[model samples]
Target: MPLRPVAALAAACTLALLGPSAAAAVALTPLPQSVRESEGSLALPGRFAIAWTGCREPMLERAAERFQRDLGRLTGVETFAAAGPRLEIACAAADPGALSLEAREAYRLQVTGEGVKLDADGPIGVLRGLATLRQLIETGPDGAAALPAVAIDDRPRFAWRGVTIDTARHFMSIETLRRQIDAMEQVKLNVLHLHLSDNEAFRVESRRYPRLHEVAGHGQFYTQAQIRDLIAYAADRGVRVVPEFDVPGHARAMTLAYPELASNPAGAPAAGAQVLNPASEAAYRFVTRLFDEMAGLFPDAYFHIGGDEVGDDAWAGDPQVEALMKTEGLTTKAQVEAHFHRRIHQALTRRGKIVVGWEEIIDTGTLPRDIVVQAWRTSNATARATALGHRTIVSAGYYLDLLNTAQFHYGFDPLDTSAAGMSPADADAARKLHPLVGRFVTDGVVVQPMAPLTPEQEALVLGGEAPIWAELVTDEMLDNRLWPRAAALAERFWSPREVRDTGDMYARLAVQQDRLRRLGLQDQAARARMASRLAPGASEPLLVLLDLVGPVRNMAHDKRVPAAIAGKKIVQNLTAMADAAPVDSLAARAFLARAERAASGEAAARAAVRADFEVWNANHRRVVAIAQDHPAVREALPISADIAEMAAVGLLALDALETGKPLAPETAARAKVVLDRADAFEAASARPIFSFFGKRPPADLIIMVTPGVRRLVEAAGG
Candidate 1:
């Protein structure tokens, strides 16, 4: 008989014998490519044990320790190392040490009646298998620790799945950074890109130039010792730490430390200084020395130069830059920028480093071909960079700071057709346009595009990153701002392209949120703490309000304060409704979507809608009571009242629909008026409040419940 026949017969026999056990298996996030369930389960003894062999690397030892700790926490049992029928972790080879194309980070995990067996080619793969095994642990009917019998073979689809944290905008503590790395490892995210310098601050200590951290860092920079420890910590968890020191532009902090290197030595601009003096040989020397020091600090091979947002006015008023431009026969500012990048690239290249920069650098075409271009702003930039023989990482759709829904990021893929909907002529024309020319032109300058990636260019795409720009994000809000959403993006990067089930992802994410919380990620707790601060004696009302609303999307909050006058006047506080909430209310959105479908006949969905309305209708009184005493809550009362009225109208419509009674015309009219009033309130509420000092918008409420309310009325009328 053929092997296929024998395999098929064995699979059928196994399934028939272990029907319930196979069916009761938990769904894994970043779903493994292949999984098989057999007849049986693994029960954890009073003392959980892990037996390891084959790899003597320090990272493997750390991984084993982590597994024991996490297993104990999750199962509430004492975990220890032992031999015999228990968890077995084996590596076929030594630790790869670094994450790269050749690193074997794939593993096979099998949990059976005998025990749990995890096998991998390297220690990194063993670490990944441990994450999956932890996720597989569940409580049995007898309330004992148990795991479903299953065999899973899994690997990431992309090699460079990463997250970029901007510590320069707002400093993050090393403890917080390490905690984030722990969560990233649990999600199998392998890279931590630290943006260490920006206009606001230089976030790393430099012994070579003390002032870079002493004066410019405002006492918030990380020491070299802390960074080395962090790198070691991340490595043990199989995460690569890539440090970014932005240059030329976003150089206010650097220039603050040494004014001689600035394009305009008059001091930083209101928009926080634009670029360094390309004409100054001293500036080049400073950058080179700084990068050399950074290279020593960050052992990772790739370094981000942050070559984005260079403005023409940056060098317009600089005499030295102008003189050099004239002497060098440089016709435009773009050429000057190109020269700046070329020199910086040469410096890094001499240090055996591969330079990485934003997509703006791609337009120069003068940098080394080995450079990695991060495409942000434009959709087609990824393809454009790849077509030019440069590797690309996409961040345009993965901008976590934009407050976009996780579904929005999930729908974006690196391999999407770059020119799918464009006309054939336009598509060809787009290809001919300068890669620097973005989709939208402002003041005759090409910015960034809004296009996608073509299939042919997909091979050059390494992966993508979710960047958390910290302009609006404080350290307290970091957890809520990143997690759960970042987890979805992680799946997009790790899982196969066909695993695009948003519903399933959400279901899995719910479990992930709890796991992350248990592992000490503080998103929920942080939000609750903020709510308690805002409400003092009573936080339930505030919590209830936050659960139904989220922050405004698309940088609307930032735009409210005009940039020209913003000038360090923009204050980030918990007073704004968005401050405590995330961009997307997944639970509310999913509930609304379900309610719309269930309005036709589903009893449970209808009840859910009714219960939501009742809660909101009662929440208004609670909000009003709390608002009188809390200024923060008072600022949101108008929006709260509108929500209450909207809910009241929805309850009336729901009643009419359930009773099969035609809604009174006046009642329907009142409902429409309430909806209109709510919309107007939201529009007016978004306007910035101009005061004696400056202009700033009060935190606007994200009206998540209104859409469901509208659906209820529409269903009643129909």
Candidate 2:
């Protein structure tokens, strides 16, 4: 089946099919086959040429220059000229054509003047359209360039296309952040959600709270000037800068700034993680100052006061908090949490900006309607918030950092009526429904439902993003975790949904991934390499197999085989014993019994490993089959399965090594290793079954070792 657009695009497509103007609505489609031939190179008709007339911003100038240079390298276009060929490039402040499509946040590129005019809706859009145009001009023989004449009506479905960067986990250099922002513009994403503070550290410089950076940031905080510089840079790309100062929970950094603000009124423990004192006036004042600084620093008119995961137990036990809650008639801990959210929301709103927070803000119930709620929980919450008229953005089940399988991510829908019921479905069929959940919660509520959307969802979405959560993720892992996949998401966000062609994208991805590799990124390359190794007829002995196995367990969060696999070398070495010890004084029967015990133990271990494969593989099949029924699922499910299978196989290999048996002479001699030495190779290549034995199991698990093994075998092209 073909790929499906995200929630927004699906709606748009539905709407397009309704009336007289349906034919004119903008929709995504695959790039013309002729143009998509080259991965990074653009193939243009002989008659087309690109020219730039006016550019004032330094970034724009730099972007244009880079485009020109890349064009030369890829398609052999030494210079851009309006009169030279078929494609013409012109830079102007306004749309030069009488008839052109205008999008809200980006440049408006139009076909005009016997060629095409690059008139961006904004600088960001201009940059993106330029990239597209560049990709269209392909290299010909002897370093020559050409162009094509094609009309495209394009715009993003969302007003806030963004990528959330967790600067607090491990400081990402300003240069790195800026580069990412530049790329975001190229993909037409219009927002940057900077997670500047978290439980790990605080990364923004504040004069009022000098210690925030000095003590909490580990010397990795961004100076105020740096923040301003980033803001300005994003402004040029038509991207808004939204700063997050997570509160209540995830505020260990703040504890360093104001020890009295910790949940423990008695004060913070020596080595325990910090929690905030929601009842303290000082806590309120500190956060207010931070927001005040943020509002002044970021002019996006929307601020994120992270009202997420505030620990109720911490606040409940604090004497100071208890006293305050009693005075306020707050009987429950949830109420106390709500009070904190209300105070922070009020603080930000008073500063002339609306607030956005995780679904917990609503769970707390005191957040005002004007505050934008980001539903990072279940779709049920999304429906609840929207039904109540609050504007919400859904981010549940899409936490990229959680290391879930792609199928798990692909199964849910942002605009799904499953949570809201058949009323909306029937209404949609009747052409009378208008997604009243978000609009009905409150007259002023604006809900933005988001998660780390799949590439297919990106098409149906207003726009999608990749959120980098701090757990198990750091700046070092950023490029690896986000690349190629993130690039796929970016295209889905910018390109029209109808333009989707998976077979074409799969081919294109193969090339784009190489481009990323050449840019000094090997993580994405490793992922792709592992995927190929798992393909049928590919060599299983490739280095990628081992890596693939570990990642599979991480993706599924199933500890059975993976936990065992993690200790393969240890187990293998311990279990692999010499056949029978020649004990001169021992009784014959006793020696035989000892030998039998050893064999039984090894057999049990092998069974355990097999069990893990059974569980994971079965689930994999179910998920893949379910996904096949949904258009969006059908298109994006392969990545998840491929990754899981690789991880599983790798772990199984680790288990095999512990079997204590000699490998076949031919096998031992022929297999080339991906990692580890010859000894490690022998250990890893043993019987891929013993590493899974004897584990405490979860209750009522559906997908067992048998199914997991089968699914992996199938995926690995067994």
Candidate 3:
């Protein structure tokens, strides 16, 4: 409602271009004073009550049950008491009255004598109507429900809605995954692209290549039984699980299992902690064996083979790889990549698995016609892959892992049909390019980007997912990093783009977050706290949430502080309080105290504050130094200064709240001024820290400076 004029215009244009059938057709009306009690559900005078028909089909039934449950939970209405206007549900008869052709794709909700009858062509249409009904529900301060009357007929432009999860970086427990699958189904997402293997972790339990799990998994691989169970679980929820195994690159985990498959002359590590050895004969054999097992485990016909981020460095470094390149008469890494991938394609063919890799694989020009290229590098790559003869999945526009905003993801076109530079020109051109490209026969390219999908673009995208990369991820930090954010991703994958109106979705997500909490997801708790502030009645929750301060610590000034003292102040404060106590009340009390103190005007507060902070920092270092060696504290420290700074800020904010005043403005401003500089420092420092112990952090006496700053700020009452 507060949208800027240009933003509003842009949104309107986007909806109009997408077409009326694609957007939720609804009218917003003020709640009539006479019907204040009926603010949510069909209690309001202008509200629409919707009934369901033909929803008993197993899939529809399952979906309907979930939808009904979500509505009840979200609107906080108990249907059993029948206090609110009830929407009746029935399976349509052989000859139910029909709507006009224009309304065929969406539902027509009419108020009947007894209740509302929601007539739709099918279950999915009914589902859309349900979503519309959900949007209509509103609660007043006194718990009144209200809604506006409107006619909505909506359908998505794309049929296959999907999201991907990277199981390769850090293996997700089957339970955690099932919960994710359930979450997806609730949001109407139909597919799950499972990135099963990556450079850091090999998740498949390979019978033919036992060593893959034995060596690469570091005792964390999923058993074959688990994969089978997961497939069944996903199917039951109407979600297809498409497995991806990155190859010719991002293969360090595989090499760990079968060292022989790795390039005999090892090169520096690449993304995913993997560096594939292209010249190893053993690598080919090992890859084939792994694929054989993968094919058997994943029933879905399409398999992902990551071929992105295989830097040219590896190809140029190995002698045997060079020799092979010369023998094949290939001059570039692209050609060698093509040659190598073709071998994997042959292996996949034998196992009845269609290969899918990154855009780089297409850049090599050797993939088979059936292969799907997940283009992550650039839009040019999507068009190039399509032009070259490979089917493409547009991830370039969506890489949610890049910390990009959702609007950016929404604006991109998966198929470059509009661009003059790469659009298909004619029949002869099509024929020549069709043989090598996957898009020639079928509209093979589907855009499935990572998170941050606006409702409109999310609906427009074939689907979207949230990838969990391991650079800053660990077992302890996974849930905190992914949840709630992943829920937003699921919404994009499941809900139609037209249904997007972040305001409403954000509200619905709050209820979903509560549900996630009931389901025992700790990560969603952090997300709920962070996201709560974006909504009304959220200040209390946001204040209480114990934010992670490591990143804040890293963001502090260039002043090098020791790691031992990094989170010392926050940890000390937390230790002083009850463990796992609600951060909100604590934060509230502290903030009020600081406010009172600042208003009193204590100049002595300045010197006393600085000296107190210095002393606290020194004490924290001693405590943290001992704590770091305590084994427990030493194990969980983050590797990056950025994370450290973030952690420091979090701790300092908590302390500042406790003192009843804001952080010292001078220190805060100084930190802000140098934040960008800190980012660069972390980027340069991360490599050495990450590479120290085979991509793990190093143990040192001083600790990192990021965490130290966190200690200083927290001690300084901010």
Candidate 4:
């Protein structure tokens, strides 16, 4: 927020004014707090430029430079210093302080031909304005660049809008992480929670405990200098980087590096080897020193000490741990973990930091009120944590690796008491699955009811985060694993609670993805890259297949990770169909929308629906050929043939509709049998075709288009 203006750019590249684009309603993501548009548009030319006034904060300059680059890249305008129509940025009232908890993010903008003004309370607010402004750029008539004539007043709904990236398992390069930060900044999201350590590896370099980096990291970790550079990079963009150092539990990597730090250094770490030596005084001292060093690197006030998943009998074989537990009245692992948390809390708090823990830390009720608990188990966890006066963040319904649709996560609000808008089937499944992450579940955890929080408790509830654990993701696959979906979820975090229209969110999401792609995110490109890897010159056919399939939902069900794929070479699991597929099939959703119209007797819609079936009926052969060549993708081969059969069924149903007659008894029975064979009982569920796999199989992709075909068949009276 402090003044640090950059040297203005004067690039000679042409802005390529492609004239005015088709006039359409604005489709802003996280939709603005208030939007009022009049009846005109502002035309921009190759000479279009930006000028600053009121304040020249370095953050503001950086925002301007980004705007200049993105505007040109997105619109082919090549923005630079010029004379004609320009964007005037005013920060006279901007809070001139370091970007942090107290920073003001409110902004108001007026766009018109006379002058376009971006006014904000701080540099961060200006960044939000510029982001919104970038989304507004469109090709007007004559293929010229233009912006809508509108007034927008916007501010974030939550103080913390973030995503937690797990880098310890699969190390993402600094570029990958930096790209994430850039995407976050564009969406007005303010936090980047880095899960830097886990059982698989420690991700941050440690000068104090060198082996934690050398041996524990397995030759892959962020250097101290890289961490500092990342921190500075995020700071400049008004994004804070919060570090997570799992303690007690998820400390296997650290123990492997420093044996003396394990709970049973005297014996081989067997029971509770995944955790620290809770009974050892040396463990406490080590935590204190390590946290102090970590605190110096991550300047944010909050720190995440993983206090989840410690087994109750983790100390079973160790007599020292047993004697200590008996002496300390620690009846359960939660209590033992709390004992560890208390020391970690004191250690981090001493270094001028507030401690954050997974929801499990709240179970023992021993930690102070200041701890922040990420309630991922259930929304009820938020209520429970806040009931105990502990600040909490909601993350239960926003697990990115769950492979849920953006609309699904978009509909899940942090303050909800009931599963209002959820399909009865999915809501029921969630209740059964809630708080139970299979092996990831901590012992005796409650499947909390969706209870509403009180006003006081709601005040204690912070924002939520979308966690993308890297076990099933690699550097190339991470973007598609996140983006476009994260953009919609970001809306949930930053926009008003009333902005719950899944339909509108998706429409705007398409535009937001294009902007994100222009800003260099690989979410839309990763699929193509993966497809080409699977099929050299014919990736297009695979892409057609990818559009209609998705990963099997639920981490417990994802077989492409270490749980099923064994060995550190889990990264090789990328060749699975899910690796190339999206979290959900947008193409399938669109097909269904058209099928709904076709069901209503729309001729054009029916024809379009038939064309889609034609594509599916034949696309499988190419996929089958590629899958035959790649054993990792062989699972897709059978699934591909099944789609062809379903497509043939759809064509049969369309023939019935065209003839204005129901299928003959024998024909109807045959069609029903085919559907019954491939259908996942409930046609709307993910993986509607692959229900035949053993509970968990590496070939884990769902045929999303099957449901649409089912709808068509039903409409044809089959």
Candidate structures ordered by lDDT, highest first? 1, 4, 2, 3
Candidate 3 lDDT over residue span 583-608, tens digit each: 11212222322322333434433333
User: How many steric overlaps does candidate 4 have?
Assistant: 15
Output the TM-score of candidate 4.
Answer: 0.88
lDDT of each: 0.75, 0.50, 0.49, 0.74
In angstroms, the error of model 3 at 513 is 5.7
Query: 407-519 in candidate 4: lDDT tens per residue?
Result: 87888888764432233353454445523323343322334455578899888878889899887788888888888788988999988787766655665676677778888
Judging by lDDT against the true structure, name the best candidate. 1
TM-scores of the candidates are 0.87, 0.61, 0.57, 0.88
| Model 2 alpha-carbon miss at residue 150, Å | 2.0
In candidate 2, what are the lDDT values of residues 1-718, reduced to their tens digit? 2222343333443344222333332222212211211112233323244455654456566666666555444543445432344334444454322111133334444432255566555455566676556544434455565443344434554444466788887688877777666555544556678898887789988888888889888889899899999888776655678888888788888887667667774554613356677777887898888779768877767788787765445664568887997799988877888888888878877888878777677767555777766655445556555654566555554455544323333344454423321233332332322232222222112223334433443333223345766544445445555444445555544554454544334334434444334334545443344333333233222222222222221222223334434543222210000101110101222222222322244444344445533554554565465544433233324433543453355344434445444334433322222112222322321211211222211210111112233322232223
Error of 1 at 213 (Å): 0.3
Model 2 alpha-carbon miss at residue 68, Å:
2.3
List, residue by residue over 1-718, the lDDT tens digit for candidate 1: 1222223323443333223343344645566666777767777754346677787577787777777778667756553233224778888888544565556789999888888889988878988898888788876666567787888888888988899999988888888898899999888989899999988899888988999999899999899999999999998888999999898899989888887777764444423455788998998988999999999889888999998887757788677877887898887888888889999999999998889999888765466789899977645677678888888987867888877678878988866634112233433443344332222223212233344545657778989899999988888888989988998888889887876766566656666667778888988888889888888988889888887777766455664344433454545554456788766676676566556755676777677777877888788899999887888788778667777888777778878888998678998898888676555534443321211122222455667666777777888882
RMSD of 3: 13.5
